[model samples]
Target chain A: MPDEAPNDPKPSAEDSPAKGPGNPAREQEPAAQAASEPEARAAEVIERERRGPSGEPVRSVTFAERKRMNRRELLKLVPLIAVGAVAIPAFRQPILNQGLRFSDWTAGALFGRHRLAQTYSDREVAPFEKFPYNFYDVADPGVDLEKWTLTVSGLVQRPGDYKMDQIQAFPKVVQNTRHVCVEGWDVIGNFGGTRASDFLRWIGADPSARFLEVTCVDGYYESIDMATVLHPQTLFCYEMYGKPLDRGHGAPLRLQMPTKLGYKQAKYLDSIKVTNVLLSDMRGYWEDQGYSWYGGL
Target chain B: MAATVAVVKQKPEETTTVVYEHPLVVRIAHWLNAVALLVMIGSGLRIFLAFPSFGPRIPQQNFFVLPPRPLTIGGWLGGALQWHFTFMWIFVGSGLLYVVYQIVTGHWRQVLFLPRDVKGLWPMARHYFLFSPKPVVDAAYNPLQKLAYTSTIFFGVVSTLTGIVMYKPAQFWWLAWPMGGYHFARSWHFFAMLGFVAFIPGHLLMVAIHGWNNFYSMITGWKREPEYLE
Candidate 1:
């Protein structure tokens, strides 16, 4: 509202000199009258003398010269048309998924990896009802704390399953950040976790690996890019809002990715598989259906 | 006086004259806008379809319908978002340049709506509806065109603001508050997109009605005209 245009008199087309015969005032203007007489005389002379090759002057003006989309212009459009034809299908999900990768690279480069996600204070937390809870499964199949373990495999030097205590034994980080959903809502939560970078390093994850494929206990699988996996804010969350995570909140372990959508933060994380393999479609659960794979800010 | 006088037939020679309607910068900006807006709308629809409603319940009276599976840009939400945010720069950058150029060059005076233009709205509408001859105004744009072009700018601002708020509610929380909240801002963003999409068809139809010279003017920045004296 503050940016509303200031009230100013605009010059409409009708305000132009001599819109039509209906404007008697414009016709009576001495300046307009003075200007029109010579123009009218010139028009009369041109009308009489001007002729096509056959000798009759054109009555209604035809923009034959200007209207034509000449061959040069038509040729110029061919490359554009071809690019559009290719880009149309290329941008879609399954086939020719080349464009998304380019878009990803461009956005990733523009908003560099170091650029931090916005943090928030307790007072700014989104209202409770606005907070969304999304998961792959119909019910939260509560994990047994005594038996559950996080398995690290693939290109990691330390390829083994570790109990919660063993995982929590590492350094912990606490962050208060906004969790944005792909469905267009947001919620703020305090997450306590170990820095994923530290954990990956602790486990000796292959630095050269292109992807870190994570599978949740709920059968949800997602492939994350190395740059995002090592993002400073990316966490292997164990606690939410101070207390340990509840059953519905991915109790044992969850990936808290502030840079990504809620869906990208795979819950009840069961395993982390670091690999150099780049799948044709590196999509998460929702992404495979039609959600964007790179749901970053 | 007799020698100077010349008789004219049914159609006058006024149309033979040529007018420089669209300037070079304006033409470039116009085409860039067309491409950017189309991509935004298509990918935006993909984003919208994911949630598809303002609230938990779907709207009872659904009018605008996309295909069961339209050939949308940006494959998925992540892909669509990349496309959306990437082209967002193009949209915003060009839009800012266009607006700044218009204001700096005094072209805003010709396009911006004013109280005076209201008086001509009905007449212009009548001219279109009743098939009456177009009034030959010596300005760059007619009253109706001025209104449409001006409103599009307003909608563009709305879309941009709402989009930013939705993108980062905590960062732009102040902007989100006036829109009622984050979800409301998203809804408003969707509505703004709808407003823009609705405007496109009407705008294209008008261009078609105005003939090839009108369309060519946007591309070549030149319009063949008639220097008619009423």
Candidate 2:
């Protein structure tokens, strides 16, 4: 801090600061001479700090003054702190309780919907006809195939722009399995149509595409990792339980995965995209706030 | 009323004292708070990462960067649930005891919240911002501290209640009903987590800025500078 040479021994003249008031000692000197003429008395006035150097007796007067001052200060600080300490616990309990509550219920609740998952005693697993159910003949709601075409895009090699027939043409494999919803529910159903793996393979799922994002006819959309999409149970089912797929059950085409929770099971499938990406500023349907993306059973 | 006579006496020098401030028990509690809060944040993140509960989610597309630890200490999700609840109770318990101790010992008023201090908040803020050395000095709990600590407590209690509502929905359905149901409880819970996330870094920075050494008094139980005790 000394602009003057480093060797400067003292506060340079320019930096000279004013000292404290003088002459107080002179007043004490007069009092000392008048009151205590004896050398021992003078010695007593020259009060050595009552707090001894290391360990020695000190006068109770000085010790008492110091002790009293400290106790007063501590006393003051204590009450002030004490006043506020009262409310702290009342506040803390609520915070902990809230955090744990929702987290506890979410996983079980969302997983409940998996019962509707397409299951086949058919396919490679078993024969569906062997179940020996009387077939209920119902007229087709007759969804126009010409007007229907599935659009798929995202981080993929060739995004799918194909028809129902086009998807049907892709070495179709259907599996009947249970659909589990994270909401603590389940459904068992039959599925017939293109497998997500076959569709992904047909599209030559891009090497970089780590997630499979599916958008439904409703504005709701869900994105899943390629691993889950490619799981043996996932399906882009076109038919359900001996009938043209009902629209209510994510008809036309829908995703049916036994392993994943219900929300991961996209319904009314419309658009598909493959990408190793996520919607940063987005939360889809149930996932808008708390639902987990994994949705694994 | 009685004096603790000084064991050591110095010859002809000014007498001064460095009084005992924080006791060992108090200091231990303080440090526990620091450690517990750290774990709470770290494990809290783990719990939150479980499903991106509440809002503002980060998509886990890159498994390599945010590798899945899955936090499966036990077989199922219940393991994490139990761990978080256990930690939460510890944190809550420590804070509860500390409050009771401070209040019983008459230290809480000085360290935490107060009525007059509430009035002094604006002046305290202005003095700090303006860099005025002549700051308002009362007995304790500067107005700013009162408000902050008070808010912290307020937030803490509300959050805990909402947490209970969400936690045992069937059990505490009555409480959640006023907040519009479990959904709102989830929303409040999310907001409270945000509050803690925001509070911690700022609290640490303030402690550092003011003086980390002074802050150490909470650990040492005594200020090194005797004049401060005065």
Per-model clash counts, in order, read 10, 69
- Fnat for each model: 0.14, 0.01
Lowest summed lDDT window (length 10), candidate 2 chain A = A51-60
Per-residue lDDT tens digits for candidate 1, residues B71-104, read 5766666667656765676677668878988999
How does candidate 1 score on lDDT? 0.65
Question: By DockQ, who's the top model here?
Answer: 1
Predicted candidate 1 versus true structure: per-residue lDDT over A183-223, tens digit per residue: 66456778899888989998999898878888888788787
Kindly list the per-residue Cα lDDT of model 2 for residues A170-288, writing each as its tens digit.
66565566543332223345667777888888877785567787777666688776666776556788877667666555568878766666677776677888876677534356554
RMSD (Cα, Å) of model 1: 11.0
lDDT of 2 at A184: 26
- In candidate 2 chain B, where is summed lDDT lowest over 10 consecutive residues? B55-64
Which ranges in model 2 have alpha carbons more than 4 Å from their true place?
Answer: A1-297, B1-16, B53-82, B178-180, B226-230
DockQ of 2: 0.04
Q: Is the docking of candidate 1 incorrect, acceptable, medium or high quality?
A: incorrect
